[model samples]
Each structure stands twice: as C-alpha cells, then as structure tokens.
Target: MNTTHPAKDLQVLAESLASVAKVTKNLDVLIFGAGLGGLAMLEVLSQSEHVSIHSIIDISEDAPAFQLAHELGVNTSTDSSAELESFRGDIIIDVTGDASLRSKLIAFKREHQVELISAKSAKLLFDMANQELRSERTIETQNSRLSLLDCMLEITLQLESRPPIHDITSRSFADIHSHVHAISGLALIFDKQSKAPQCVGAIGENAPDCSEIESCQSCNGIILDACSRLSQKERYKLFKPSIQIKCQAIENCYNVALPLWQDTRLSGVLLFDIQAPLSKEQKTTLKMASVHLNMTFKTLDHFQQLEEMAIFDALTGVFNRRKFDMQLHQEVSRIKRMKNGTLTCGFIDLDDFKQINDTYGHQTGDLVLKHIATSIESCIRDYDLCARYGGDEFVILLPSDDAMQGSCLERIGMRILEKVANFDLVNAPEIKTSVSIGLVTQSGETAHAETLLKKADEALYEAKKSGKGCLRIFADEQFHYTPSKE
Candidate 1:
C-alpha cells in the first residue's frame, strides 16, 4: 500500500537529477556578426557570471566591432559556418538581423543538439545590457566633472596667489595648456596709444617670440588679419563675449579669441587653438579663466607703463643717459663676440641753443627738443639706439657689419640735416636751430664705449670750430669736417 520496493529509490534518483539540472553551468557563447549589437552582446556575455563568449564571426575584417574584437584578443572569423560547425558551442547568438541566416541556424539547431538564438532575441539581450551600461556611464561622467572642477579650483587659487604679472600669465597659460586640448596659443595685450596688439605669452609649436612686449610687432599682422575678417556686427558681439575663428590650416581646430576689457577699453586678447564647438563645461571654464587673464594683463600693463617712465627721458620721450649707458654696454659686448665688428658713435650738440632759449621761453625750448627727438626717431633704424645724452646734447649708437663701408652713417647724417632744416612749429617764428654732429667709426672688436664717446666728443668740438651746421667724421684719430652748403 505504501509503494514499497524500488519505486521509492526511483523517486529519490529523479529528485537528485532535477537538483543537478538546476545548478547553472558556464556556457561557451559564439557571437555571429561583429556589429554594434553583436559586440554589445559579446561584452555582456563575457562579463556575465554564468556565461562566457569564446569567439566572434563577421564577413568583413574591417568592421568597427571586428577591430574591437581583435583588440580584445577574442578569436574571430570571416566565415560564420566554419566557426558554427567547428566550435560546437553551448550557444550561438545571431545579431546580424539576417533572416536567411536565422532560418538556416534554426534548421541547424534542429539537427544538432546545440542551442541557437535568433537576431530578435539577441536584440533584447543587447538592449538590457545597454541600459545597465548607460547607468554606469552616467555615474562616471559625473565623477569626471567633479574631478575637473577640483582641478579648476586649484588653478584659480594658483592664479590668485599674487605673483609677478608675467609669472601669473605664464602659470595661467601652462595650466590651460595642460587642461585644454589645443595645438597652439598666443596671449596678447593691447597698446591703446599705438592701437597695436602686443604678444605677452605663447605656447606650443610655431609660437611667436616676443620677449619685449612693447616694441615687438610680430603678432600685429596676425591680429590685424583676424580683425579685418570680423564684421561690425561680429565686432559688437566681442563686447559681450569671445569669438571663435576657424583656422583652415589646422583641421578641426578653432582659434578662440577672448576679449579682455577694463572700463570699456579692450585691454588685451587671450587667443588659443582648440577643437571647435566646445562643451558647456569647457566654455564656462574658458570664460572664467579669461576674466582672470584680463585682470592680470591690466595689472601688467600698468607696471610696464611705470617702467617706461623710469627708463625714458621725461621731455624728449627718448632713452635717458642711464639707459643709453646700459644699451652701449650691451652693444659693445655683442660687437666683441663678432669676428670683425664696426661700431659708429655720433655726438650731436644743438648749435646756438642757448641763444634760442634766451629768445624763446623754456616752453619753446622744450618744444624744440621734442621736435628734434621726433626727427632723430624718424631717421634711425629700429635696432639703432638714440638717447638724450644730456641737456641740448644727444648720442646715437650705430652697429654695422665689417662690410658696411660707412655709407649708412653718411645717409643718416644727411637725413637728420634735412629733417632739422624743414622743422616747423606752431605759434613760433622762423627761428632756425642747427646741429653740429661728430661721428667716430671704429673698426675691430677692441673699441670700448668710453673711447668711442671721447673721440666723438673731440670731433664735435672740431665741427663746432669749422662752422655752425656741419658734420665731422672722425677716423684713425683724425677729424674730417664736411660743411653743409645750405
């Protein structure tokens, strides 16, 4: 009545088999079609706690997912049937959305004991895995944003430590260079009086070199060329915000120019090359950094003006005696390094200056000195040094190569005479002021600044003796005075 004999043993054996079947096994999954969905399923299966992906199959070797599979070292094939027959996998997933292949695989599964998943079923698996991955990526992106924010805060603190203006700019540029993905950058400040852009800093390849910001015009042409392209409407937009210039030279890079303003004046420009169409976070960071750069450039410009006031003559707007001595020493050192250096020093004294001062007040004398300074500046090259040596006397340093033959000096003397002869002043009579110039051309690297100045002074005395308006060229310790026919 209680089912005795082997019936109980048979029931126990059946229960044991069911329990064994319930235990999960790690299945070898072979993914068909190395497409986006196929790759996605392969990744999911590989990371699963109960399944493993062993191989991938795609007809084209150059598919994106195929390349990824190769990089991951997953066994791959250009033929699907070979892998399907050879692998004898626990499961084969068809994600190519090929209906013909799906029908063939279904028939093959009917004959073989192996399981096969249709493309539609594979899509479901891929979708579920993709949702989970998106959630994880969202968290990762937020963490990245936080980390970048921390870096920004650190950079802001560094900028606020009150270092030298140049140091501040250099440090700021270095920080940007590290954080921003860019090719090259140029930082420039505006000279309002000259209406020119002065390069303050540069980073990366082919960057402009402008050690002295005030006198350098290397970036002027570049800035002007950019400005010329901007319309009035675009220029107005710069008042409110920055602008991006498309650089045809660099692929996928934009020239970002941030305008710096102080009390309605365009104080400077912070320019850099970056991949265009910036993200929201990157745009915000750039705007904030630009604000800091504007402050730094404004402060630097103030200090630069003060430095100029110290080194330049107050009335004549030329180099003072102290600066002249420093420049002469520098040029002398350069000449000594050359094989055969020729340097010409010219001493200029205003003839009948005292009589002119007596006739006209000191105000007119100041005006005359300014006029002479202007004339001297017009006649000399930018590299040549002109300084107000003392009251009513000026000095000039002309450096030349050994092959110059002194023609430049002769031309400069003539030009100065002509400019002085044509001097015109407002609210003053036709009072003519002549200059007695004595020039000493010294060859060989042995000539010192003191010796050259003394020789030029001696020649000045000789020119004064010859006539009122004349030039004397002193060579080989002898003076040769040339009286002006005018």
Candidate 2:
C-alpha cells in the first residue's frame, strides 16, 4: 500500500534525522510503526557518520518508515513482530510503544544483555535543537537587534549538513520566523557605494524590492547618487552622533540604514528601526551580527581551503588521486561544451623516494617532498593545475591558449633539475630526489579527461624506463583511466 505525507514535512523530517545520524557511526536499530516520529528518528540515524541505520520495521511495506528510509539511502523492509536476536539492531526504539516489541527487547536483555532507547527518549533531540538556536542568537551575554545576514549565519550553525533543508525548514518555520522578527522586524540590505538597497530573501515587513541598496527615496527630495557626492567622516559633525553614516544614501534613510561593507565596497545595507527607536540590547545585535558575518565568511573560506588541502599530499601539498578524478570530470565537461579547449596534463613520479625514506627516515624524505612541492608551485602558472597523485606521484595540468604544453613541460623539467641540485633541508644531511615527468595535451576535444590521464600515466612509465628525471609526452597510443579532481 502507498503511504502519503506532505513533501515539505518529509524533507524537514529527513534533514533532522540526518543531523542525529551524523553524531554516531554504528546503529543496530529496530523501529516499529514507520509513522512520522519513527521516520524522524530513522532519518537522524542514517545521516550520521560511522553509523549505519539498520532496517526499520512496520506492518505495511509502503509505510512512512519504508519510503523515507529508501530516500535516506538505507536498507529497509517491514516486519510484524521484530525479534531482537533475529534482527540486526544494536538498540531498538519502540516508537509504537507496542508491548510486544518492548517485551522482546526486555526478554533479550535478561538472556543476552541488550541496551535500548525508548521512543520517549527522542524528545531530548528537540530540546537540544532549541538550545542550539538560543546559543546562536545570544551575543556575548548581551541583547541586540539582528540583521537578516546575521540570522542566516546563525541558522546555518544551528543546522548540520545531515538534515535535508526541507525537513528543517518546515519543522523550524515558526521558530525561525519568530527568531527573525526578534532580531529585526524588517531587515534591509543596501549598496553603500551607490546608495541602492536590494531585496534578497527577507523575513520581516520592511523588506524592499531590489537585492542591493538603491537611493533611499522614502521621503527624499535630494538624491545621493554616489560615494563621491558625500563624506561620512564630516557628516557626524552636523547631527551630533545621530548621523550614524557620514556618507549618505541621501538624507531620508538615516534613521534605519546599517551599512554592510565587504572588501571596501558596499556589499549592502542591513537596515532596521526596531519598535521603540533603538534599545542598547538591540544595538548590540547589530554589532554581534557584523562580527558573526565576518567570522562566518572566514569559516566558509577556510572550509574550502581545507577541502583543497585534503586532496594534497601532506608533504607535497598537491592534489591527490581522488582530486585528479574530479578535475578530469570537470575538464571533460568543458571540452565537451567547447569542442576546442587547451587540455594539457602531466604525471610525475619521484625517483628513489622510497630509497630516501628507507635510508634517512620518513622525516627527511618528507622534507624532500616539501621542497619539490615548493619548486613545482613556483614554476606553474596560476591557471595551471598541480596535485599530489598519491605516494610519490604528482600531476599537473596546463590549459594554455597559445603556449605549447611540450615547451612548457620541458622548461619545468629543466627548472626541477636546477631546483633539486640546490638542496637545503634545514641542517639535515644533503639528499637527492628527482621526478620523472609525463605530459599530454590536446588542442581539440578528441578524448575524455580520463583518457588523457591514462595516456599521461603511461607516458610517465615510459619516462621512468628512459631515465629517472626526464619527461615524456603522449603520442598515438591512448589509454583510459578516470582522474581525480584537484
């Protein structure tokens, strides 16, 4: 039988479930009912890391537990009477509160010693969710008016990637909206340079039309067209601190316009007036919002940097084999679309890296890899790609518009010889490490990125046979292998 639930509800349920699942890696779970609450618990369990949400049980195969579990990528089926010994769950949650299932688990405990969490225990998760939200809203033990941007940042923190957005949005809608108004009744974003406010996604009443701040025409007769037209530094002199902005969006917007500056350009304005002018607590909100935004952006940027680092060899700081595959897929799409794009790839393997590791220990061997990475980074252009393709293997890509990839590879090979010769390993004994390079290029789309990588790999093997520190280019023969993204 086909079961039904609102899509929004399902999405929110899924997300929340994913969040819970991320907390643990192992789950021997036997759930009964497959109803809303049961699916929610299951969703939380499956999205978790190291935890596998075992099958959920209910009488009907098409029940919410069965359907939602499939969506969450879990193995699921239905059972009328779930037996603890016969089933594969570490802990069984009796969502149905069915005495039979509970009895089964209790009986098992007497004979085999089993631990179980009741359906009632799930309520703790909701309490935890509330605390997370409260912490996000609180600003250093002070109160303040919140901007929309600040609210968005806090919302992100409150949620882990586990919950599907749909589930979290619906479940937390009222709380989220109320939280929004509590921060700012109407948050406005305006462009500081041009004095234009644009309407991005907004929660309160004061939301405007455009996504950026435009000239404030609210009660305006005079238009402040550009940053050059007014000076924010001297404007404070006239209004005795009431002039919060020295530069104006002209005069009408002075009461509520909060400038958002990023990189010296007006990203937008976060404007709000609150109910009774501005309370000190409300004022603190703006300060906190700004602080949080700066940190949030930095955190996001850092996550990206860390992701890039993950694909790198610890010593070499280059893309690993996993990254090569991802990059190859992207390049394949690029070449498929254009039909004519520069695609140059190379594979380089360090000669005697293992011997060096065996002789001087991994510490000195690491230094050699570090020095090689630095040398390679300096020689490659900004557009050229570089990555550690696992072990002592390295790969590089040059998508040039005009320069010959062969010529470029030759120059890099000679430079590596020179760089390797001038060895300085920080007081460690002098050691030698060299790279065998293989290069491949295509001016037009004839093969996929995987094929190119294969050719490059084969060429590198040929390079090793020819000599340890030489370069080889792909010729008529082509091989196929998927490369990782860098």
Candidate 3:
C-alpha cells in the first residue's frame, strides 16, 4: 500500500540534481540495493571526480540509499528486473549482499556483456574511493595552510618598513578576501582613547558605503555590538581571535570579526562576509592571520614611541637640541641650492628665568618653560622649526624665498612676545616674564649652520643688552633694533 507521488518526487529530484551538478564526472555506475552498504557506497562515489552515478535500485522505495540516490539526481527504481532491461551503464555494483541477486546479476552480465562487480569487490572499491577522497582533502587543507603562512610572512616583512596603517589594513583585507573567498571585507582602526573607529578600509563589490563620516556612522553600531560580545579575557590577549556573527546587512551570509590587539588593548577589528560556513582549516588560517596583524600593530606603535623619544624633548614636547642641529644643517643645504632663497635663524633667551627658579623652586620654573615653549610653537608656521636649544633657551629656523623676510621675522617675533606676556601662573599671578630674541637672516650669500647660529646669538646678546624684553635683527653687515609694538 505504498503509493509514490510522482509529481512531488520529480520536483524534489530536479532541485537535488541541480545542486549536485556543481561537480561533474565521467565513469558511469549502477548500484544495487538501498541498504546501509549501498548508502555508504553512494556517499563515497558522489564525491569522486571520475565517477558519475547512473542508477540505483532497491526493492523498498523508502530505503536510505534509494532516497539518497534520488536526491543526488541518479535514476532509481523499485523493480530491479525492469531497471536492468534499460541499464546502459559501464558497471553494475551489487552492494545488497544477496546471493540470489548476485547469481541473477552474473547471468545478466554474461548475457548483456556488461561488467558485474560482486558485493565484496564493490565494498573494496568503496573503501579505496573513500581513502582517495580523504587524501585529496588532506592535500587541499595543507595547501591552504601554506598559502596563509606565506601571506602572514609577506605582511610581516612589509610591517618592518613602517608603512602607514591604511596601507597595512588595505593590503591585509585584500589578501584575506582572495584567500577565503569572502563576499566583502572591512578593516576599522579604533582610537585608543575614544574606543571608536577612527579609520576604515573596505574592499569588494558588496562593501558598505562607509567612505564618508555619515555613511560610516551606520556601521559603527554593528561593529561595536559585535565587539562587546567578546569576553574581557579575549579582548586583552595580544592575539585575540576572530569570532562569527550573523550578518544583518546581507541575508544568507555571516561575518567573521577578528579583533586586532596591541598588547593588552583592543586596537581594531577586521570583518569579512562569507557566503558559506568556513572549514576547519580556513578558521585556523584566520586565527593565525589575526595574530600576525596584532604583532604588526604592536611593532609599529613601539617604533613610533622610540622615534619620538629620540627627537622630542620629554619635558616640553618640542624638538630637542639634537634634532635642531640636524634640521638646521639640512635647511642650510636647501638654501644653498636655491641660490636666491632667504634663511632666518632666531635665538631666544628667557630673561630673569634663574631668579624665578630660585624664588619659586625648579618645579614652577619647569611649568614656565613649558608655557614658553607652547607660546613660541603657536606663533610659528608649520614649515618653521622650533627647538629647545637648552634650559630657558629656544631656537627657531624659518626658510623663505620672499622679499619681505625681515618683516616676516619681525611679525613672528612680535607674536611670540605677545603670547609669552599672556602666560599667568596659578600660584603667583604677580610674577612676570619675557623673552629677548636675536634674529639673523641670510639671502643670496654663502651660509653655514654654525655661522648663522653664531650671528643670531650675537644679535640676541644685543637684545638682552638693550635691557631685555625686546627683539634685534642682524642683517646687511649691521645690527638693527626691531622695536616692540608695546
């Protein structure tokens, strides 16, 4: 009393066949039985690149192998004699383990001149196919691992050059996309203080439009929500691994968010969308890559700290004397090449600084020095160099090709004096301080860094001698007093 619904069966058969046709093969096979052995054989043969399942037969229509063969798009039947009459395959694989069926197949094979593989031989062939499939998968996994390692090595080498963070993110995303076949990828660098994404790098045709601030705001919520799900322990780890999250923007896809860390802090996140679930090997590759990215960020940050320490004053946060010496020489060389360019050097000395330190203690004097450095920095252009030449002393270099070089120097000097006069001490508002600046300009003349500095120093001596709190310029083989507009 088992009636088959042919219409529904045909529909299911068509859909199953469509999905299976993704891989094609050549050797034609006809299988007997829908029992456990037959199901196992079908499973193994379906993955083989050289085998094409032609038909499968079993007495019971509801057997496992019968349903599986139907799903795989192979022809199936309950009546073995009827199917054999129409069989035009290369081989008959009898997995039913029935002696009577075997005898019948032997006679049919002799009469029709078709190959008959007995139940035992068929089982052996199935085992070999299964082994071959496993070997192929092993090789594929090894290849994928090697590719990921090579990519990490390339990125590590690039990091040594200390390229911009954007370059690192873009290249890393592209490589991951190519290797993992992700639908799209995005990398976000978070601000260490704000903990919000400060920069973004996106790739792929389906990437979200996050190039502008307004557009990026839409994704911020999603990324932060994903990050919040990680445990505190995971976030603090240097190689915080990637986690899977449901992709809200794209249906039928999921996102992998890899947390990039710099030591104990969360630095950034790399997210990519994948259409299918990743394999074990793919997941391993991603975890290893995330570790490499974390190391890269850490190395770059360390290098930046070292570089700043080497060139910047720890107290005032301005270029130190050593850096000033290096820049002065470079600027002198550049002026020499121009032949008609003007170079100006100004030497600054804080007047009555020692008395302030002796009266209020060195701590107060330190604050005063810091304030002076900030004041001078505010008055200079981006191209101008300001350095703490020594305690209570600063130097500035301005290179220009304009004819109003003297007037420009005067304006800068006036601005510095105005800024310094505005500084007020919290504890002692009555305490007053000022700077005496000596400036020297060189134009269309042979110049040296030391000679320019010496001339500026001489000009500074004149300013200080003129009762301090004033500016003097040495130019045209003479000393000119730059009257303060006060």
Candidate 4:
C-alpha cells in the first residue's frame, strides 16, 4: 500500500489547477460536484489569477465544497439544473460521475455552446496541467537560484575592498530592495558611545533622519520602538528568530526588520516595508541575504581591530612609538624635498604622573595618560601628528614653511597646558594633572628626524628643570622658556 502526503498532494493539485487556468484566456469554470474531486478543484481554481470560478453545485447542500465556496465568496447551490440554466461559463467540469447529470450537462453544453469535460477527461487534463506546472516551476526555481547567486557574488566582491559602512549599507539596501520590492528601507547601526540606534542609510520618501537627532519626530513611534527594542541584547533575542510588524506609518503595509549580529552581540538592523506578504521562497532568500550582511559586518570589524592594533597605542589610543617613527621619517623626507621648509617637534611628558598612580592606583594612572593624550590631540592642528613615545611621554610633529614663527608654537603649548590643568579625577578630586612640553623648530639646513627628537628632548629637560609644568623651546642654538602661568 502506498501512503500519500496530504499537504504535498494539496499543493501539487493547486499548482495543476492554476496552470490549467493560466493557459486558457479568462476561463470561467463551473464545477458540478462538491465531494472530494469538486472540493479539490474549487480550492485551487479559486486562487488562480487568470481563472474565475463561477459556481459549484451538488444535490446535497451539506457538501464539503459548499462551505469552502461560501468562505471563498464563490457561488454555491444544491440545484445543478437550476445553476446550469443561470451559468454563463466557458467550460463545465462534471466531477459527479453521474450518468444523468452528464446527460443534462451535454444537453446544456449543446444549447449554450459551452465545452463540457466529463470526469474521466477531466483527470487527463489535470495530469497534463500538473506536468506543465512542474516544468514551469523547475525553470523558475533555476532562474531564481541563479539570480540569488549573482546577487551574493556582487556583494562579496564589493566587500573585498572594505568600503565604509555607509557604502555597504546602501549597496545592501539596493540589493535587497530589488528582490523584496519594499516601499521604504532603512539601515541602522548601534552606536557604542550614544548607546542607541543611528540611522546610517535611508531610502524612500519622508524617511526620517535619525543619524544625528536624538529622536525622529516624523517616524512612527511604533517603528522607533521596534528599532530600539532590537538594539538591546535581551530584547533582540526575543525577536531574533523572525520579526514582521504592521507599519503604523503606511496603511496596509508591514515592516520587516532583520537583525545583523556580530558574534553574540547585535550590531545593526535592516528594515523595510512590504505592501504584500512574502512567499516561503522569498523569505528564505531574505534570510540568506541577511546572513551575508552579518558576515560582512563581522569581517569589517575584524579588519578594523587588526588595523588599530598595528598603528595605535593600546592604552592611550594614539599612534604608538613605531608608527611615530615611520611618520617622522616620511615627514623629514617630505620637508627636505621642499624649499626652506621647517618641521617643529614637541616632546610632552605628564608632570607627577607616577605620583598620581602611586597615590590613587594604576587604573587612575591609565586614565590620566588617556586624558593627557586627548588634551594634546585636541590642541593640535588637523595636520599635526601625536604619538605616545613611551610611558608618560608623547611626541607631536608639526610641519610648516620658513615663514612659520615661534609664536604659533607658543600658543599650541599654552592651549595644551590649559586643557591639562583643568583635569581632575572624579573619585580622587584632590589629584591634579599638568604636562611639561618642549618645542624645537628645525629649518631645511638641519632637518633630521633623529636630530629633531634630540633637540626636543633637551628642551624638555630644561622645561622640567625650570619647573614641572612649563614649556621650553630650543631654537637658533638657544633655549627659550615659557612658564605655565599665562
């Protein structure tokens, strides 16, 4: 004995009926039975885009297909002859297998000039339709898979260059929009500093600019709430499996949000609106695209971490000694090639940093180091380079032409001193912080990275000797001191 799968059989039957209806032009079908065969035909034909089911009839009003026809808004009756008299259909399918009903249908067909298919001939037509449906579905599936593969390949190639996150977001939105036919789309990433979701990319009219604003006034509160919920770890897990919510902004539209995860943490979100519901295959395709997006984010993050480790100081978040040396060499060569260019190097050391650590703790010492580095960086010009040479020591490189004077250097030193003097530990309020800076200016005649560093170091020694919180400049073979007062 062979057992049949009910769900699969129903799907196949539905596809076959749809295929038959599609091949005929605006075919109006009247099904004459409400038992198993009629019920199956009605179920599939009702959903066909090209076919309209006119009516279903049987002798018994309690037939299974009557309930379904009523639910589907199709006409139903227990009087076959009465229904046939009123029927204005192109074809009548008699699945009752009744000799008397067939004879009546034949007479009706002859008088009304409509085609009539008996139960045995109906089976043959259904078999042909089933074969056609299977062949069409095979071609469609192959084409869909090829299209999906092409999309994934393009995304992978674009990611290989490691473009900015915004570029990645826009490209991904366009790719997904092509397949999903969304009305509006938004890409958002969780900002670590703000601890909120920031919209990086948006498409469609009336889209809110949540990039810099604290809250989006134009966006629906429900949509914003959904975004906020997905940003949290616990809440993200609740909707992590699948999320589809009604869009309050657009009537009869639904919003779909896909979470982009970096390992266990939720990194970002992909959101879009759909006017119609998605099929199972379409949903699977979207899941695949989202997974690819997640992998792209993870890859970018790993590369950025590796780059930071290579060129930045771990403790202070400034350029490390090795990177500074490389920059020093490059700047020296660049200045040498120019006509009468000068490079100014400043050597900075935190005053009483060791005392701060000994008095408070190593953690406090680390904070002080970071604070000084930030202060120095904030005071310098955009083109200047700041680096951590060693513990409690930083170097700044400023390149200028011959007309550049010492007054500019004096102003930079004073700003750094002012910024550092304002530093006070939150818990250890009594702890004060200041920096001793030494500046040296080198002209085209004597512009060497090593020599410039040496002169800066000598000036730094003089500044320390004069007072811990002062600035000294070594220029023209003489030492000039600038006290930290004003």
| Winning candidate number (lDDT) | 3
Candidate 3, residue 55: Cα displacement in angstroms equals 2.0
Better structure of 1 and 2 per TM-score: 1
The stretch of ten residues in a row with the least summed lDDT in candidate 2 is 232-241
Per-prediction TM-score to the true structure, in the order listed: 0.51, 0.43, 0.81, 0.62
Better of 2 and 4 by TM-score: 4
Looking at model 1, report the run of 10 residues with the lowest lDDT sum.
Answer: 232-241
**Which should have the higher TM-score, number 3 or number 4?**
3
Instruction: Please report the TM-score between candidate 2 and the true structure.
Output: 0.43
**TM-score ranking from best candidate downward:** 3, 4, 1, 2
Candidate 4 structure quality by residue, lDDT tens digits, 1-486: 215455555554456456656666688889989998888777666656767888898889999999999999999888777888788877888888898788888899789877777666565556656676778877886677578668777877876677877667767777776676667776766656654666677666556454433254334344456755654233112233334333333222235777777776666677776554666556766777776777788888898888789889999989998888998889898888888898999999998888888888999999999999999999987888999999999999998866357888888888988998888777988878888899999887678988998999999999888876899988878988896653
- lDDT tens readout by residue for model 3, 155-257: 7887668898767776777777777777767677777787777446667765544444224544566567676764524422122244332243322223576
Query: Candidate 2's residue-wise lDDT over 235-311, tens digit each?
Result: 11112223222223222223333343343444433333234455454454445555554344345446656776767
Cα lDDT of model 1 by residue, 257-352, tens digit: 555555456655556676666655456556556655665556656666777887799899999888888888888877878887888889888878
lDDT, residue 413, model 4 = 89
Number of clashing residue pairs in every model?
A: 0, 53, 0, 0
**Overall lDDT per candidate, in order of appearance:** 0.69, 0.55, 0.77, 0.76
